[model samples]
Target: MSRDDRQARRGYHHGNLKQALVDATLELVVERGPQGFTMAEAARKAGVSAGAPYRHFKGREEIIEEAARQGFEMFADLMEHAYASAPPSALARFEATGRAYLAFARKFPGHYITMFESGLPIAQNSDLKRTTDRAFAVLTRAAEELIARMPKDKRPPASMVSNHIWAMSHGVVELFSRGQPGTKTPFAPEDLLESGIGIYLRGLGLIERDD
Candidate 1:
């Protein structure tokens, strides 16, 4: 066996080696993009021998994939909590979820980037797929609730509305929240998202009634 493999086999007995590798991988992901580094580099950064990471991850891709998976899990939890704690109004709950989405991106920039921009093969990772789907389901559920309250003839399809809201929220985060160059908005990202959603609802003829 290669010397690196021997070192990795030794590392398997270290109680915290797996977590150490994961932490090191996260640091690397932030400094370099997810695809920027290798498993050996992560092991070295973690203060372990080059082969140490092999005990925890099959390869560098698995390391990045796990990071992305954890990120999605956190994202889904944040959305769920936002929805659950929101005011009784459907609109309020929906708006709260949007705000939570933006807050998550801001609070955990590294996780957010990996979760959305890592370019990991989510289709091949059931855990990642499930976590991502859970996060998205929050938005879709909120949309369904809102549409259910409208007159059937006046309601837009829940799936389409959900997609529109998700697109708008993501756009606001990328363009305004992240401070990307070009068209600067006077409004804060949160306000912009709120106002944009309001306008969209109004355009759909879904007027908000004072509760």
Candidate 2:
């Protein structure tokens, strides 16, 4: 091989190896479910020798786990920004965080699937668990702020409120936002989520009729 071609090839192998593998894994994940593809395929897609990936990742599972870890960090940042960008009203901030959840799922479908559907438990990795908790905490923080508006005697546990709303938001994303073609819902996911939160708040007597 010519010296210039060899130089270029060397750069390809060494340049940002981990990120290239991660990006390749994400593409494969979108094209095929997490378990559907092999490590060799990931190397091929990343344009490296089949053995190149082992320098950065032990196996496909590690690649997917890394993707999930990054996804949660990005998810937490988006939710934090959404919570801050809204008006100070507790309801508005709470709703903003919920919308952010849907937005992340739609924009990062591969990450979403790997993070939630790949059957990798976040608790297995301390860093992954911390990242996941940060993302979930944004929702719980919003819930606590919103629920605080209620009379203390009538307030529900913030964890309960957050978990319920998280479950509702997750359902909307999976059924509607995740590009599921056959599943039909008459209402847009945003409408469904906002109105559902409203109803839940009203049911708890946390939402006053006047405003």
Candidate 3:
């Protein structure tokens, strides 16, 4: 068969081709935009036969979706660690976890970008969505505790408060990761998240006097 014909077929050459293809595609996605990437190119990058990706990914969309899935899993693991190491208070855990979230984004810029691809069919991938939601739930739970302690008159719902804080951290991290160095905006990523969250806590009227 011609190289083009061989490339168009759906089947990989050997064991581990799936992982190899995924790895190659991730590098490609970082190098190239996610939309234009081709599975055949991933196979070539992996040093596998042109058709190798088919053994694992049904199509380019599947490859992209799975790559995104991997990103969410990495994020969830980091949040799990942050939640465990945080001090015994909702505010403490929220701050620490926000730091962890920023650290993860800074350290894994490629993976972090992939996780929030609204274009990808995340709803179809329930398991991956569930894992991502679990991480978000950690943040929401902390917000809920703070909200509950409020005198009801001044309290916002946990989900609303969590969304505000999450948007703050996520926007800052994303802008910083895009190489916006020290823009000195009112809310610098680090200061804004840690301190901004503290401000939110105070407004919520939930003070945990710690040593």
Highest lDDT against the true fold, candidate:
2
* Residue 108 displacement (Å), model 3: 2.0
Q: Count the clashes in each prediction.
A: 0, 0, 1
- Evaluated at residue 125, the lDDT of candidate 3 is 80
Candidate 2 overall Cα lDDT vs. reference?
A: 0.86
Worst 10 residues of 3 by lDDT: 6-15
Candidate that scores best on TM-score: 2
Span of 10 residues, lowest total lDDT, candidate 1: 4-13
List model 3 lDDT by residue over 100-208, tens digit each. 8888877776566567643776667897778779888877777776677677887888888878887878877766545665664645578867776777666665664
Which parts of model 3 have CA positions greater than 4 angstroms off?
Answer: 1-15, 180-188, 202-211
Cand. 3 TM to true fold = 0.80
Please list the C-alpha lDDT of all candidates, in the order they appear.
Answer: 0.82, 0.86, 0.73
What would the TM-scores of all predictions be?
A: 0.83, 0.90, 0.80
Model 1 / residue 120 / CA error / Å: 1.8
Query: lDDT-based ranking, best first?
Result: 2, 1, 3
TM-score of predicted model 1? 0.83
lDDT of 2 at 199: 91
Of 1 and 3, the candidate ranking higher by TM-score: 1
